[model samples]
Target: MAFDGKLLANLSVLAAVVESGNFARAADALGLTASGVSRAISRMEARLGIRLLHRTTRSITLTDEGERFYAEVRPLLVGIEEAASHAGGASLSVRGRLRVNVDPLFSRHVLAPRLPEFMARHSDLEIELITRDDLGDIIGEGVDVAVRFGFPPSSSLVARQLLETRIITVASPAYLKKHGHPCTPADIASHTCIQFRDSQTRRPFDWEFHKGRKVVPVTTHGPLLVSDAGTLMSVCIAGGGLAQMMAIGVVQDHLARKKLVQVLPDWADERFPLYAFYPSRHHPAAKVRSFIDFCLEILA
Candidate 1:
């Protein structure tokens, strides 16, 4: 048999059903009725001569054959999407549904502020930003792009460095006045220091301060521990304890406003990197390219 356009169309419906985990949601996304979605799947099953999904009244799961087929189909779908976006020349193939996995801090403090301008520039683009603490199976979750802080561990995805944010040690004025400011990096061990939990390790990261050519590690002990950057900032601002924070972005505003004062500036030479990751580097979709460029502009 030759190629059939209807079969190609059904692939998207299948993708939507598997991604959304239900026919009703898949139908809504594709602008079809639930019964219509059911009919389309039935047609696909008949043409393929295999049950792709183990369907119950309440749930849907892929059969072993369907699992293997879907693995191959995912890459094909991604290629089709990228090709569609590049149909037009280099004027930015920015027209498409862009799925982004964004770090919470960057989403709230950086991207959210400039979103209106970005959307205005690309009227054809539709953005779906998912803000979370960790990057999990972007390909499986259908994420087109992801932005995160720190160096990404080894991965097959292309990670582009967006910025190297300066790191600073800071504490509120009242807290410093009561506890007395530390004079050197080693003195930090005697002072209460905020602790941040590493997402992958689930262990509190050791506090470190950097200077000209020296890196000093200070064992930190604090009354509180937190996973969220916002919570860390909040407690530090309330005169709770000393914290190490980024010197750029909303984090810097506290320093400028005098709500928080930099401590041990001599050891504040450390920098944390931020990166934007995507599945492919070759002929990336216009949406991915445009969004990354937008991030570079704002973070600049």
Candidate 2:
């Protein structure tokens, strides 16, 4: 039997399709036509005499035989890329397309403002910062890393604590002036407090004030309910209403500029943790490590 020269290339195409969830996207990633990608899969299937993909008009999934084959081939594909990188002197380089999934608020206010600095430091790096309401399938979607508030959502992914920010309640000077200042957390209910709905849960968040061991849950209501952090912050800055937000990051800038002022500081003891999550790998690539370190430096 002849050694198949196209075996590795076809396997790579299959891996790309699995990572991208569709052939069109896989083709785009690999610089190939969609029909070309389809043909490659077809060739591999015919050669192996097994069905690899279950195709529908809208979605594509791996068949059992395909899944087993992919499981065997995935590591080889990864290792080949690493070997190629090492041979090309790119193993030590922080130069590759680094796809990061991040929160919308963090992307807009925190990362966007400071991204130029990172880009300057890593002139060869191509960074793609994708902002979505929730953390999607990082492994399946080919994401390098993800930064989000709170804790790790899944046990499968390795998580690192980037920073911890105090949960602070704030209001613009004009809003406080017009609505009268709420000296106590209890008094917030009487004023128009901006509400932020949780992305995972459609329900609005209940405000909480904390001081050491004491915790007070404050039920808040407002004329407007929002699901976006940027909009909530904007409304608070523009004297729309009072809002609770992280004291650091963009909120610190607001405080420095006198755009927003912290209210009830004595009771603001709760700290929100920010984490960086990545899929587990024995020998993670240089680009992934570089990105994670950069995040820690910025968050610090």
Candidate 3:
């Protein structure tokens, strides 16, 4: 097909439909009628001699061919939009939907409280945040950026280090008073320890501690194993057990109020690095770049 204004318009419509999940929603997003959007998609399919979507009365899904085609065209569409915005000199006016995937603990404790400021700064941008502990397939899930803990594996996406926070072992003051504080990592075996399980792997996270250039991984048994850091913090606050958690997840007010006490402070030398990951940036969207810079500034 020859590259022209009409072809670009139709491609834009196709991208919107796939992103929004329905013709009506895509039309609303693009300031077109539902019938107009549907006609454009039908025209494209007829021209290409391929069905792009499997549609029913209630829902619509991409066909296998549609998925591959979208993957190939989506980045090109983004590049075109960026080029157009630069041509018009509208780079400062960042406006679009930004989908983010974040760890549950980071979402609740670190990002959630600070989101109002970010939204206020970029009033034109729309945000959709999905919080999960496990690292999902970012490209397949249509995530613009993902905030994750620990080191991410090598992948197609670009990874930038946000920050590293210390992991502290903590328990309620009442529990520590009743059970006595642990003097060494080995002493945890005699006390109640709270555990966190990997949501994707279904395996408990090993409690790591460092002392004088040596790192140790301790296996702990607990009455409760949780997949969420917030819930694990709550259990620990109620004197359920000891928990090893990132400093970002620890409530400073709780520590000041003596609701939670840091145990093994000398041994709390392990640090976990947080990263913001996104797709390749041959032509990075303004919305994604702006949001990432905003987060880095806030977290700095």
Q: In order, what lDDT does every prediction score?
A: 0.89, 0.87, 0.85
At residue 92, what lDDT does model 3 achieve? Answer: 52
Q: At residue 267, what lDDT does model 1 achieve? A: 93
Angstrom error at residue 297, model 1: 0.9
User: In lDDT terms, how accurate is model 1?
Assistant: 0.89
Worst 10 residues of 1 by lDDT: 84-93
lDDT (10s digit) by residue, model 3, range 49-120: 899999999888889998898899899999988987664543456677789999887888888988998899
Q: How many clashes in each structure?
A: 0, 0, 0
lDDT of 2 by residue, 1-300 (tens): 776779878998999999999999999999999999999999999989999999999999999999999999888888988988664654478787889999887778778888898889888889898998777799999998898887677469988888888999999999988888788889988888888887666778779999998999998888898888888899999999989988766788889899998999999999888888888755666777887888777777
lDDT of 1 by residue, 130-158 (tens): 99988888989999999988888798999
- Can you give the TM-score per candidate against the true fold? 0.71, 0.69, 0.70
Best by the TM-score measure: 1
Clashing pairs in 2: none
- Put the candidates in TM-score order, highest first: 1, 3, 2
Each prediction's RMSD to truth: 15.1, 15.1, 14.8
Q: Kindly report which residue stretches of model 1 are placed more than 4 angstroms away from their true locations once superposed.
A: 1-92
Give Cα distance to truth, residue 190, candidate 1, Å. 1.3
Candidate 2 lDDT score relative to the true structure: 0.87
